[model samples]
Target chain A: MKKLINDPKNVVDESVAGFGLAHPDIVTVSADPLFVARAQGASQGKVGIVSGGGSGHEPLHAGFVGFGMLSAAVPGPVFTSPTPDPIVAATLASDGGAGVLHIVKNYTGDVLNFETAADLADAEGVRVVSVIVDDDVAVKDSLYTAGRRGVAGTVVVEKVAGAAAERGDDLDAVAAIATRANANTRSMGVALTSGTVPHAGEPSFVLPEDEIEIGIGIHGEPGRERIKLEPADGIVDRLLAPILEDLPFASGDKVLLFVNGMGGTPLVEQYIVYRHAAEVLAEKGIEVARSLVGSFVTSLEMQGVSLTVTRLDDELTELWDAPVETAALRWGR
Target chain B: MKKLINDPKNVVDESVAGFGLAHPDIVTVSADPLFVARAQGASQGKVGIVSGGGSGHEPLHAGFVGFGMLSAAVPGPVFTSPTPDPIVAATLASDGGAGVLHIVKNYTGDVLNFETAADLADAEGVRVVSVIVDDDVAVKDSLYTAGRRGVAGTVVVEKVAGAAAERGDDLDAVAAIATRANANTRSMGVALTSGTVPHAGEPSFVLPEDEIEIGIGIHGEPGRERIKLEPADGIVDRLLAPILEDLPFASGDKVLLFVNGMGGTPLVEQYIVYRHAAEVLAEKGIEVARSLVGSFVTSLEMQGVSLTVTRLDDELTELWDAPVETAALRWGR
Candidate 1:
């Protein structure tokens, strides 16, 4: 694997170290039970927002730590769930006496660990809630799969929930917002190339040239099927169709559209896909109230893109428009 | 060959359309002589900032247009220089009564076209100045090269110049800051794999799985040498060494370090390199006043990373820290 890592085993630790130094203005890290917290101290009367998962999908959890985003993010190795230790530590550290909420993607390992951490934190006098994001519609009624795996919608969940928390909402209210955002979103992706997991020193999976795997999972998991390659317009239609139907985003509905590159796709390509996706949505009379197009959530050097749509009401739209300051996504001080 | 594009010939126009829609809060576009301008309109008395170049290196000129960055950006086809007409158009569209400044990278086509446009704009009663950035130290007096090519340092020039203009600096003052930023900065890059231009429909150049090309230019231009793949630490040292000596970044000097991905590199890998670069600088007693690590300037999905270091004085540091909001970069606004 042509990865920029000194040692495959040290990828997560080294990357976290690098991230802490690069964004000192945004985060502070405490190792041992590793977690990254906002540089500013947690507010005493506000709810604490915490999210964590495997490492590779960068600017996802760690890069989202700042005001108006996650208060703390616990990171494990690439494609491996963080054990309960860091999640519990993150919960306690991020707690502002209001409580802590864990935003967990619905991967089997991640769900198990975060659930255990929530239980452990609750037992220790820190009230905790977990919002599981299972927005990927690509799994599509497969009896062999674990429902749907969470994908880019975790970003929207963290963003909207963090905004609500920043606005001094109670823990319950923040948790409610997170749940609503998660429920309203759906995502699907296709991988032109597989991600090379650092430890494996090989791609998580491989596909032949001239074909792509549709309904791919974020961890480089096998998708529902391998399909012949198509143009940007066709690819968007494939990803967007399931998303639109799953969310049932109807005419005149306001929404936020996220076109995310899976690591290796360039911004130009992402924009190209966005062009077709936006046109498709416009044709359906769905107004994209807010749009994000980039590698906000990415597999490690995987060539692919995912489409995420979040149906929005005024409450969600206003919260989405609220100011956020993070290393990756920043606006409106 | 695997890219999210409808047609190779239409990539630029389609991506521009997508960009305009995605960032409507920050930019507005004019169809003819195509240019992206600040959506909120330019301040009447401030210097107008404009930059343009090939399309592939995204978030460069186009993504920088907004309140505290470029007043306008004109983009050409992928890896090809924009002609004089659009540059002239952007210069005119961005001008308030103050004047317009063109930030040109040191590619022959870009410099020639921008110079021609400047002359035309001057003839049309719009005062114009061009600041050429040639910060890459990788060329190293090679006869095969046209001296050093511009790279990531262009981002620094636009940001600092934009801040100066936002502070109501006159055209000369803003141009001077941009010029100084360019002069004080140095960059070098290493590409693990070549980028495929859309129209070309093939890889620009190929490196075997076990090798990397050091000092490669943004458009897949030949570099100083092709070497065996090295660890991230070794790679950072190679790229950062030339940048440090060229700027002669001193023991006690304050500098801003930018670790840029050439499109395809993930944020995690960029951070991994940033970690090593930061450590190397600290060992030399240089204090990194600011750090920007991401794919700010990228070749279309090139698997590479570039290191840029700029010696920062109080003026430059404050200007760098100033609040600015753009589609790609934002802070303190």
Candidate 2:
């Protein structure tokens, strides 16, 4: 594998150390248990927000740790779930007088670990609440998940919930906001190529040169179908059909449209996807109120794209527009 | 090539259209001559900053168009230099009452075309000053360039120069700042795989599975040497040696360290590189006063990275910290 790494075993630690050094003003790294926390620490009276998952999909939990976003992020090994120890440690570190909220993706491993962490934190006198995100509409169950797997919609949940917590919302309020955002969000992905994990030294799956995988999961889970490669618009139609119907997003409903790159795709292509998706939404009389296009959440060097749509009300829109300063996502500050 | 595009001939236009749609609040797209201009147009009295080049290396010229950055951007076909017509159009559109400055990379075609555009704009009564950025320390000259090819250091030039223009500096003053930044900057890149141009339908160059090209140019040009892929630190040592000696960067020199991914590499690996590069600098006693890391400048999904270091004074540091908003780079704002 042609990856710029020293040892596969040290990828997460070294990368985390580099992240801490690059943004010392924004985040602090704890080496003992490997959790990234806000450099300024948790606010005295504001509810703390924390989330985490596998290491390969970067800029997700760790890169989102900063003002107006996550308070702490716990990362596991590449494509593997973190144990409850680090999650509990992160929860404790992020907790303030207002308690803490854990935004967990709906994968079986992630859900179980976060649950155990919440219980452990509660035992230590910290009020903890957990909200599970299951916004991927591609499959009902996959390799690492029981129900629908959480995907790019986790970004929506983190941003909105983090905004609420930053504005001094209580633990319950932040959890409710996160849960609501997860419920209203839908995401679907298509992979043009499989990503090889550093340790595995091989691609997770073999895809022919002329075929594409539709409804693929972030962890290279088998998708709904694999078909011959088609035009960009045709692929968009297939991915968007399920997402729109799953949310049943109706005409006149305003929403935030996000087109994300699956690591290896360029920004130009992501914008092309965004352009056509926006055009399709306009044609269906659905209002594209807000738009985000880039590679925020990615599967280590996979070449593909994911589309996410989040139904937004006035409150949600305002929260989305609020100032945020993170290593990956930043705006309105 | 398996690319996410429609007709290869329509790639630039369609992507530009998508970019305009994605960031309508920040930029305005013109189709006639094809240029991306700031949404609010040129400030009434502030000197305008403009930059452009071939497409594919995205988020470079077009993505940098917004407040406190390029006033206008012109993009050509993929991996091809733009003609003088669009360059002139963008120049005229960005000209305020004060004047306009053109930041051109050192590639031969880009230099000649931008010079012609500047002359045309001068004839139109807009005072224009042009600055060429040639910060790659890779080689004295190579394909597509008469001098050292401009690489990721163009970002340093545009950002510092954009801030100068935004603060109401005259055209000459902005050009001087840009020239200074370019002079102090040095960059080197390494490529593990060649990037495929959409229209080319093949990779730019072929390489065996176990070797990498060090000092590789952004356009897949031949580099200094080809050797078996080594560990990340060893590769970084080789890339940083020439950069340090080219400027003869001395101990105690305060600088800004920028680690830019060349498209296909994952963020984790980029950070791993940054970790080692920063350690090397620290060992040399060069103070890393400011840091900018990410895939700001890219080579169309090539698996590689470029490292850039800019000597910073108090003025440049303040300018770098200035508030700016663009599709790709945004911070203090």
Model 2 Cα shift for residue A142 (angstroms): 0.7
Q: State residue B186's C-alpha deviation in candidate 1, in Å.
A: 0.8
lDDT of 1 by residue, B106-137 (tens): 88888889999999999999999989889989
Residue range A264-313, candidate 2, lDDT tens digits = 88887888888889999999999988989888889999999999999999
Per-candidate iRMS values, in order, are 0.7, 0.9
**What are the runs in model 2 whose C-alpha is more than 4 Å off?**
none
Worst 10 residues of 2 chain A by lDDT: A266-275
For every candidate, what share of the true interface contacts is present?
A: 0.75, 0.65
The C-alpha RMSD in Å for every predicted model, in order, reads: 1.4, 0.8
Off by over 4 Å in 1: A140-145, B140-145
